[model samples]
Target chain A: MPQIFRRGRFWIQLGVVVALMAFGGLLINNITVNLIRTGLGLDFGWLWRPAGFALAETALPYAPTDSYAWALVIGWMNSLKVILVGLLLATMLGVAAGAARSSRNRLLRSLSGGYVALIRQVPLLLQLLFWYFVAFLGLPDTPVGGLIHFSNQGIRLLGLNLSVEFCSVLTGLVVFTGASIAEIVRGGINAVSLGQWEAFRSLGLLEGVGLRRIVLPQALPAILPALTSQFLNLAKNSTLAIAVGYADLYAVSDTTITQTGRAIEGFLLLLLSFLLLNLLISGGMALMNGAVLGRLQRSR
Target chain B: MNRWLDRWLTLMLLALLGWAGWSCLHWLWRGADWTVVVTNLPLYAVGSYPEAERWRPLLCIVAVVVLIVITLLGTRHGEWRRSLPLLWSAMAPLGIWLLAGGLGLSPVGTQSWGGFSLTLLLTAGSGLLALPLGIVLALGRRSDLPVLRGGSTAYIELMRAIPLIAVLFFGQLLIPLFLPPGVEINRVLRAVVAFALFAAAYIAEDVRGGLQAIPPTQREAAAVLGLSPRQSLQLVVLPQALRVALPSLTNQAVGLLQNTSLMAILGLVELLGISRSLLANPAFIGRYLEVYIWLAAVYWLACTAMALLARHLEIQLDPVRSAR
Candidate 1:
């Protein structure tokens, strides 16, 4: 009976593998036939072609005459720039708002609660449009002390100039993702014991110091895992920069594919780039998590 | 000093709130024109579905609203409560039939399907398809067979790693290439397939989380009861696991609805897509604020309604609560 059961399992596994291969083969055969019919067989020589479309913003020097590969690299850098800055700003906003939710002040708690409720309910794309068309574009052209400038065209703070598209995408991503991260932070903090809060109070620790030194440290293990996922989500959501014409990685890829009509090759490149991005993010978080756990263990 | 600090913070917050409220009120009264939303109500709801046939999508929306009200209000009644799941399951088919319209009414081409109806169809259609596919993937990942486990894990991780717009874009561009030369799918169907494929990966993770929460003894107990493994899964394990997954699944459903707006970029005239074209028209050219605010409110309400319905289902499915 045991031998028969083992044989049945082996056969089932074999069947599944064979079926998958057959389905895959059929799809590939069709793709080859379609490619031949359309005369667009897969090729990467287009990457060397000049990309004629102008980018609204670039972190590195770029022009319409640049190679498609160069344009894509610039776009990837732009994505990385926004994502890193957005992650930092969002974490600050999220932690502040999340801590506010647990603050002793009733108004502060309700305000943060309201923020999360309002932000989470609306679609991020709509908010991005709002920030672009209504908020940033509606700004009056005003120069402040030769140090800062705000206008319908763009914004300048200190020595840095920012386009309306980039500003809107950043603001939208920060606000939308901040709301989710706030929820995660709040949940993580809540997991810390009521006793911990009381213990800190009894010791007469200042609210900021207690939260920073005591409560938050204990909450890190729980918060870090959820926070990692939220960070991944923010990275993914940054692609919506396309809707606002921010020239992020996906937007550039979209334009490239449209111009060259190389959908499969473009998609493959996009996929590989994203997989690398995801690995970089999750790997960084894993390191932080290990450090946090190590420190916590050492202290104990 | 601490008391003074608290009072100062309160005053500052209050002042900021007051200014924001005043500005919002001023915008509503004088700075905003809502005629953009008011004038295009039909277009927003049915998206230029033939003027004569607007009633089909309207009826479908009305049916859904009525069903929601009935389920919320009538779930206490025994027979009505028992039939609620059936009615909910029937909605997607009913919606498709009403909008597609071949049985007794004129059949409308998908090109004419747009607005809120298309949005609802995309969400419901993809969701209905994704749920079962997700369950199978989750089971496969948890399967003892090495090939099944590795394949399912690879698919889920790969799908999750890519951004959704990329998936939808390729779905529009490349779905044709994968099919036999003569066989083709419409844009709406392609979008649905892509959405389902993308969403199933996320849903499988949620279901896996729920599956892991179930105690091992439940399966052992089922075995002791002489139940086959299939029967044990179908009867004992899956029901409990799904119930445990209900809240997270609700989040996915809401996320799916919001993500449907991504379809607008691919040129399907769902709610946001219809609005995008309307905004492009010379007349409504600069009325982005009014249109966007209206869209935001519509999405918020729809998402809230979904959340409430899911909460109701969660309560209904609770063994302790239902026992009462």
Candidate 2:
């Protein structure tokens, strides 16, 4: 009888269910009382009203007279812009640095190692502040005719327009996250066995060819998962755009809250937007991962 | 030997170096001033903490250093390991009293606690608080009860999905609304709570990985020894799990330490905030480069030290490595 009382799934389930229900009711009651006392109800209807604040660099055509919902959407677009650009730049820099860390060239290897150590050790927010307040802001107020031009074909193809806010945020995110991705890349590369490199050398392949053809393909398995997480991290870290007064989602939400006094709504929107953005990134990456695995399986 | 290719690479590297050298020289000549940074070193270190009470923070720093040294040394012996938790908890209150001063010392408000000391305090406080809370949450997520598992999973996922900046904003803005009228929380405490909650999610995930690594047979063995599920978990499972989780947990802790800089957004003048405020001063108008360089160097040193300490602990905790 004692054994039955202790081990019975039915009794245990019933107890847990009842306890959870009671706890949930208590939490709801407390929240309701708090809301009533504060004279703020849970209606999101206030989002339809005017935002009344202008964003500095918005992807969409936004005015001070736009609805709060549109303003939030503009914030979302701005965040997306930064994340997309930041991810591309960070990956490029990370891959280059990661390669440099293992290069035969002594100076390149040491420089990359030093960079990874220094950047990764410092806080990202601090680094962002450095890029903004120091590097970008310190640039002599946009040379005589605003945008400086380097008309070389390569420079033209790269399309480097140094807008202060965009450049600062991009540079900061790239440097900070690039350092992390470099470590991941290095780890991924190192994870490939030495025997494979030996096999490539035996086939009379150059070092570069060996890495590109043999090592990196195997390294992709280790790299992809870390790279995917870094993408999510980059998207989330874009929220630090607030610190530099950049018009990203969190910055726009801050403005919306200050202008409209709708903290709950604005914050909820901010949370949901980031959550959804990350979910999309994670989902897309998972699909890519599946495809990669399928290809590898077929080859096997 | 690939002489021709090597020669081309060397020439290209030389050109790159020459360009970099020229740029460095130009920046030093035209873009930087160190006078402002030299003058404001004290202000950056302790912020506006009163001159008379400066020694209080210094003392707190000394105490913290002593505690850390003791804890590191304590790990070598088994008996000391058992008392380490109690020692840490005791140090928390003692350190708080020494810094804040209510027991035979002067009272220094959290506002006065800024700069590097405050940065360290926030990191240590949040890291310590988050570890146990995260363990509980991880265990709850792995619990057999559907409701408990679901609730824990939701909390962890929600926290993970959102940015720390958003979490800080929630703490700064929404938490006040939830609190009853005439009750208040300090800005420092709010920032700490936000950091702790944010870090707990990551810690929970790390711990879950550790928990999953533990074999099911361990639990079965504990059960055969007449242990209840809870007892088996506490005695048989958690110790091994925590050992496995230590490296990842340390990584999370180091990450949390670096992240405490975000509290600057909440208007708490930690190390980074002081640097920002220094740049805003009229006297330091164009010296952003100098100020930032100094701040980065300090932050880098501290973070590197923590990373090294974590590595040391990782080695010590592993029986194979320790035996070597």
**Residues A63-88, model 1: lDDT tens digits:** 99999999999999999999999999
lDDT of 2 by residue, B163-200 (tens): 99889878887666656566788888888888898899
Candidate 1 lDDT tens digits, B1-324:
777888999999999999999999999999898888999999999897999999999999999989999987775678987888898999999999999999998999999999999999999999999999999999888887889889999999999999998999999999999999889899999999999999999999999989999998888888789987778888999999999999999999999999999988888999999989999999888998889989999999999999999998898789999799
- Name the best candidate (by TM-score): 1
List the candidate 1 regions with Cα displacement exceeding 4 Å.
Answer: A1-7
Residue B185, candidate 2: C-alpha displacement in angstroms? 1.5
What is the lDDT of every predicted structure here? 0.92, 0.80
Model 2 lDDT tens row, A137-231: 65553333434532211111234643567777888999989998999999999999989989988998887788887888888788989999899
Worst 10 residues of 1 chain B by lDDT: B72-81
The local distance difference test score of model 1 is 0.92
User: TM-score for model 1?
Assistant: 0.98
Candidate 2: where is the Cα deviation over 4 Å?
Answer: A1-31, A140-162, B1-32, B66-89, B224-228, B321-324
